[model samples]
Target: MTVAANGVLPRPSRRRPPVTWGNPLTYGLALAVAAVSIAPVVYVIVGGFRTTPQIVADPAGLPDPWVFDNYARVLTQSDFWGQAFNSAVIALGTTLGVVVLGVCAAFVLARYTFRGREALYTFFTLGLLFPAGAAILPLYLMLRDLNLINSYYAVMLPQIAFALPLTIVILRPFLAAIPRELEDAAAIDGTGRLGFLWLIVLPLSRPALVTVGILAFVASWNAFLLPLLVLGDVSLHTLPLGVQNFSSQYTSDTAGILAFTSLAMLPALLFFTFAEKQIVGGLQGAVKG
Candidate 1:
């Protein structure tokens, strides 16, 4: 028996609760997981500042003198900026296309119950399973036939097509989560189908839309194979292709390659950082719904 604060004997000190081994083990495992996940990013950041010789010599240590010229070279280089612009345009265009088409498709899929609906979804989703590389020849021929090869539109169109299925997959559930009463209420208030979508669905889907937008941006921005095959002009090359050029031009300059790689990754990094909260919130909403 335990004594009470007052002088009476209390219940055996309530036995304090037994500390299990699981708690400490779980904390240790979580810390280990976090460290593993962070190690590569740390390595990349450190390696970006080191010279080729330093990286070849150490491969793992912090840069001794911490040279910043890598960043300076990347920023000052004219090719880098132009390629970055190409990436930006493609990413923006793809995001817009995916959003417009995905939202429309998702609205139909979620709100309607027509025949062959599942088959239609399956057809759209088939694109996701088909590797973009597998479609290269077909895409090239089609774009060439349309006289769009070597043009930004060629890359932009394929990127949008490839990204649409995933965007639709993301948006469908989010659209479904919205209560039907909202749309019915809007309809009762004289809102037409387009008006209902424009005012009701679009506004409520900001988070999901932002999430898909970020995904589309990143995918299109980093697209290598499609653009590489289609875009032949140096002026039209995206960041990934530009980095490949940097590698070819500076084959002996490993430091320069690392620098270019680091520079190429910057836009994606900044975009994810800025949109991380919205992405997380959107995913959580989708999961909870």
Candidate 2:
């Protein structure tokens, strides 16, 4: 330790090291994987600007003279907008349901002490292993019997249920990390349990909630099989179902199909992109806790 003229030792520096990209091979592999995942999406968006002849001549070539006709036509279609609205409704509904239910359940599991609490949490953890595909048959039958087969609830309800486990899993740790002193302080300040949760817990857990909400929204937006099984009506179709129907209807119109697909997926991609940081922060907090 260095001593100053006054004979006091200097304070140690706490600055972090300068960051650098480590492991060239790892970065190369990551870039390769990202390229592979992104190539098809890029192709679809770029293909929307090319004519059918250009695509047929050079399957992987860029647009020579970019044209906006494909996208323009898609925008002009009433079906596209209608399907988009349906998708927005379902995604938003699913996000709201998942966040509300997941938060309530996670708060209970994290804060309360009771018999079978761990068991209940474990039961929810087990739900993670159950995929929607396995239960689609019975789900469809149940929805059908309930006369909800053609309704938005048919998709939103099951999606919320399937999303609950992960949502709670991510949120429980975040909520539990709230120091007990804060709860006591809130109690002394005339805050009840629900009021504490509302006034303090929710604000503190915003990142985790946003993470789960975006996940649920994106999942619901991209869902196909459930909507396909339940939403047979053309008027009720979500974007995925709309994409399939559009592709089928325009089998030979490759450019138009590509445009339609690009448009359909753009919203979810944009939404996720914008909220990427919250997702990472929430997951990091969960891991830290």
Candidate 3:
């Protein structure tokens, strides 16, 4: 047997594992799901250029006589620009507020446990149970009492408050995972709490920050009810409110509605397109933390 083994090649030692996509059915199903999800977005963008009649006749097909007038008209509208600017302001302000307050609060709660810490955190976490729409009545009353109606603060303040709970939830786990030894070393080397936060904790927390910041920005940009309730001035309308108003103003114009909606959604789409990888990558790192 030993001599025979030497004379002939040995039998194969092992078999390779099957390739992941070797199953046609599995890949086919994945492609179907992707197509289903992407179809509506594609239709919206394409349908924006179609006339009302064309859209009605062939809702899923390309425009025969493509109309650029609808988008061009919207582009020239001052109200569109005003609302878009308002949306940018609200998104930026709310994200900044949530980041600064959430980071500082999450750092303290995660690093140094004190009396009522659990209670406070639980209280904030409870905010997640109820959405902004659920608390509309009281929110309106509080804002009215503060004379903040029809103001940017009316929108931004509530958004900041509502965003905090989620920000804390995202940030606390990551911050708590930070090594205490590094903070202690910083303290020995003349770093105060603020200094340790700025020089150490914040730098290490880029992933969590990016994740929460994007979330807050997106949520604020897409907010509807709060802005609708608080903002009576047409000039102060955000993008969502603008879309609603635009649709109402052009009630008979389906093409205009589709075009406005497509335009309104473009900022969010472009932002996600670029930052999709960042959000995914950061989330992977943050989950480990």
**Worst window of 10 by summed lDDT in candidate 1:** 1-10
lDDT of 3: 0.86
lDDT for each residue of candidate 1 in 250-283, tens digit (9 for 90 to 100): 8878777887887788778887888889778766
- Residue 96 lDDT in model 2? 99
TM-score of each: 0.81, 0.87, 0.87
In angstroms, what RMSD does candidate 2 have relative to the true structure? 7.2
lDDT of 2 by residue, 1-289 (tens): 2213432223346455445554556566678889999998999999999988888899899999999999999999638999999999999999999999999999999998999999999999899899889999999999999999889999999999999998999999889989999999999999999999999999998878898898788788889999999999999999899999999988898999999999988987888789889777766765765
C-alpha lDDT of all candidate models, in order: 0.83, 0.89, 0.86
**Candidate 1 vs candidate 2, TM-score winner:** 2
Across residues 141-236, which tens digit of lDDT does each residue of candidate 3 receive?
Answer: 999999999999999999999989878987888898899899899999999988999999998989779889998898899998999899999889
RMSD for each of the candidates: 7.4, 7.2, 7.6
Query: Cα deviation of 16 in candidate 1 (Å)?
Result: 21
- lDDT score, candidate 1: 0.83
Q: After superposition, how far is residue 92 of candidate 1 from its true place, in Å?
A: 0.7
